[model samples]
Target: MALNEDLQLQALRLLQADPARSQRDLAKALGISVGRTNYCLRALLDRGWIKIQNFRNSRNKRAYLYLLTPQGIDAKARIAARFLQRKEAEYAALQAEIARLRAEVKADAET
Candidate 1:
């Protein structure tokens, strides 16, 4: 599956917060299937945005750590800025719409 920018940003944030989290946990938090999470992770790895290391001390041999590279950190910042801009614009539009609706309601009440 194609990894969208939103998913990429969220995954990066989650992994950065706790690199030792399992893929299943990540997928659960992300509300996506494990397979899709795996795909997204592979894409991130291929892009050099993230690096994976096995956790030797963990009892679960399959346990791994996902680390964000410098590039990934920079990418996450950019993505977060863009996401904030979009949300701000959407909020402004919604605010305007609410004002318009309130005005209509007031006018109807006055009539």
Candidate 2:
């Protein structure tokens, strides 16, 4: 529900989907700043949720791949479930508000 949690979940999914994407590319996909992406990634790395590996005999020496650890995979699943629950709750609330506002508008028109 918090911004960071959402970002973390999103980042996990993206990395799981494609770890080869550059940080800039990941930022673009997540719709966050590169700085923010780095911050989130560092947090994940520190937590031991993910690990970065350098390629062997690769052209781009600086290029690295992000991989989720076993714990990270489990965390991703849990976070995804929580995010879905939160979003569903938000959707229900918004639908209720829209209905209430529509009733108010109809009442105003009748008067």
- lDDT of each residue in 12-93, candidate 2, tens digit only: 9999999888899999999988888888888899888899998777899988899999999999999999999999999999
| Cα-based TM-score, every candidate | 0.96, 0.88
* Model 1: residues with Cα > 4 Å off, grouped in runs: none
Model 2 bad stretches (over 4 Å): 1-3
RMSD in order of candidates: 0.8, 2.4
TM-score of 2: 0.88
What is the C-alpha local distance difference test score of each model?
0.95, 0.90
Error of 1 at 32 (Å): 0.4
* lDDT by residue for model 1 (20-91), tens: 999999999999999999999999999999999999888889999999999999999999999999999999
Q: Ten-residue segment with the worst summed lDDT in candidate 1?
A: 1-10
